[model samples]
Target: MNQTVRPERRVLAQRVTLAHGGGGKAMRDLIEDVFTSVFAPPGMEDQARLMDASLLEPGAELAFTTDSFVVSPMEFPGGDIGTISVCGTVNDLAVGGARPLWLSAAFIIEEGVEITTLRQIAASMQKSALEAGVRIVTGDTKVVGKGSGDGVFVTTAGIGVIPPGRRMLAESVRPGDIALVSGVLGDHGAAILAARGDMDLTSDIRSDCQPLNHLIEAVLTAVPDIRAARDATRGGLASALNEVAYAAGVGIEITEADLPLRQEVRGICEILGLDPLYLANEGTLVLFVPPDQAVSALAAMKSVPAGRGARVIGKAVTAHPGTVIMKTVLGGARIVDMLVGEQLPRIC
Candidate 1:
C-alpha cells in the first residue's frame, strides 16, 4: 500500500521580503504559511480544475469578471483589503444574475509588510468567500520594493454560472420600469474618507461591506424579469444610473426625498461639499423591475439582511432619453451627470 506524506507547515518571517517572491524555498514557505494555509485551495496545482453539475445543464452560461483593489489604508472601520477584494468580485457576478462559484486572488505585496497583515487578509477572504458561497481556488503572489507599491494590492477574478432562461440587460430597461436601491448609499465612501484621517475628520460610520449574492437571489426570486442591475461602486449611484440610461436609451428620474442616506454620511458630505449620490458603496446595488412587480421586488430585498434599508428611489422615463434627472427635496430638478474627476483617490 502507498500513502501520501504531508509536509509540515513552515514558519515564515515576520515581514515580507524580496526573497519571498523569488520562487524559492522562502517563497514556498510564505505561500504555505500565510495564504494557502488560510485559503485551503484544492490541490497544489498551478491552475484550478473545476467541475459542476450546474455547468452541465443545458443553456447554462458562464460568467467571468475581474477587479483590482487598491484602497488606501488597507484596513478600514468595517472591512479591509481582503474583504473588499472578494466582495467586489462576487458582487460583480451577483448583479449580473450569476451564481458565483470560484475566485482567484493575486497579491502584489510591498516589502516589509507584516506577515500578520497578509494572514488577516487571507482570513477575511476565506470568511467572505464562505458567506458568498464561493471558493478561493487558486492565486499568485509577487513582492515588490517597499516604495514601489502600496502595502498590498489585491486583484481578484471570479467565475459563475447563469441559469438558463434568465437574462438581464440594461438595454431592456423600459420607460415604465421602476428603480430601486438595495440600501443606503455613500456609506463605504464616507467610511473610507473618515478612516483616512488626513482631513482631520471623524465619523462613526462603517463601510457597508458585505456579499450581495444572497440579496440578488432574493430579488430575482420575487421578480425574475428584472430588467437591469448594477452595483454602485467606484463612480457611485449617479454614474451607474447614467450608464444604464445611455445603454437603454431611456431617461432616469430619482427623487432626492426617497434616497436612503445615513445622517453621518449626509453630514460628512455637507461639510466637505461633496455629493452623496456620487459617493461609493460596496454592498449597495440598483435594479430595475416592471412597475407592477416593483413592490414585490422591494419586499423581497427587504427580507435580505444586506438590503433591509432598501427603498424605491425612482423610475425610468421616456421624456428625456439618455439622461439622469433628480428631483430635489426643494422641488427643483438637476442633472445627475457622471463624475468629472476623482472625488477621492485610491478609494476601492
Candidate 2:
C-alpha cells in the first residue's frame, strides 16, 4: 500500500540558545519569527531584508544622532530601556533644532532570555515611536551565550531635518544669553538607583524618559533666536553647561534657588551623598536664549507637557570664560566643575 509519506514536523525552539546567534537557519528563523515579526508587520519591508542603508531626501540638512542604553533592571518606573532607546536618540536630534524623522535600532540579546520579554520591549519601542512621530525603518539582532551578556542592550541611531534659519550650537552662545532647564533634575538617576534595590531605599521617583522634539519645536517657534540647546543626559546639567561654556568661550552663572529640584530627588541625593547636578537625566534639556527672549522662551517651554516645570536658571557671562559658577543660597558662589569621573554608571 502506498502510504502517504508524511513530511517531518519542524519544532520551534522555545528559548534562545547559542545556535540562535549562529549565521545559519536557526539564526534566520529567530530573526524572521521573533525580531522581524515583532518590528515589521506582514507585507512590510522587513528589517531582515538588510538593505545597504536608508535613504534621505536630497538637499535637506540633516541632524543625526546615536545612543546606547544599558540601564540595569531593564524595567524601571515610568519607562524602560526600550522607551529610553527611542527617546534618547530623538532628543539628541531635537536639541540640535531638528525634527526627528527616522530611527534604526540594534539589539544585543543574551541567550535564555524569554521571547516574551523581547516582544514587550519591541512593543514599547513602537509606542514610543508613535508618540515621538518617528519611524523605525531598520534594525539588527544578535544573541550571545547566556552568561556572556546581559538580558538585552539596545542601541539606536536617528536622523532628523534641520529647519531653515534655525542654527542652534554651542559656539552660537553669546554673553547675555539666558540658560533654561526643561524640568526637575536628577529624577532619572535617582529612579535608576532606587530601582536597583541595592541600598534598600525606596522612593516615588520615576525616570523622566520622554521625547522632547515637540517641546523643542515649540521653543524654537516662539524664540527663533535660541543660541544653543542640549539634553542633560550623562553628567547632568553641570556637564551640559560646562561643555557649552567652553565651546562658546563664555562663563555661566546660575542661581541655586532658581534650580528646580524635586523634593524626592533632593532627598535621595542628600542621602546618597550625590550631587544632582552631575546625575543623568533622560527627559531634561538645557537651552541658551538671548536675555531679551528668555521670558518668551520660558513661556514657550512651559506650554509643553515635557517642559511644564521649565525655568530660567542662569545666564552666560564674559568673566571666567569656560567655567560654570553657581550662586549659593548662603550668598556665596561655588564653581560647578565638570565631573572628573562617572558618578552613577549605567543609569542611562
TM-score of each: 0.99, 0.91
Q: Residue-wise lDDT of candidate 1 within 145-170, one digit each (tens)?
A: 98999899999999999999988889
Model 2 sits at a Cα RMSD from the real structure of 4.9
- Tens-digit per-residue lDDT, 208-248, candidate 2: 99999999999988998889999999999999999999999
Q: Please, what's the RMSD in Å of model 1?
A: 0.8
Q: Among these predicted structures, which one has the highest lDDT? A: 1
Lowest-sum lDDT 10-residue window in model 2: 47-56
Alpha carbon lDDT at 82, candidate 1: 98
C-alpha positional error of residue 161 in candidate 2 after TM-score superposition, expressed in Å = 1.2
In terms of TM-score, how similar is model 2 to the real structure? Answer: 0.91
lDDT of 1 at 193: 96
How high is the lDDT of residue 34 in model 2?
Answer: 61
* CA deviation > 4 Å runs, candidate 2: 1-14, 41-59
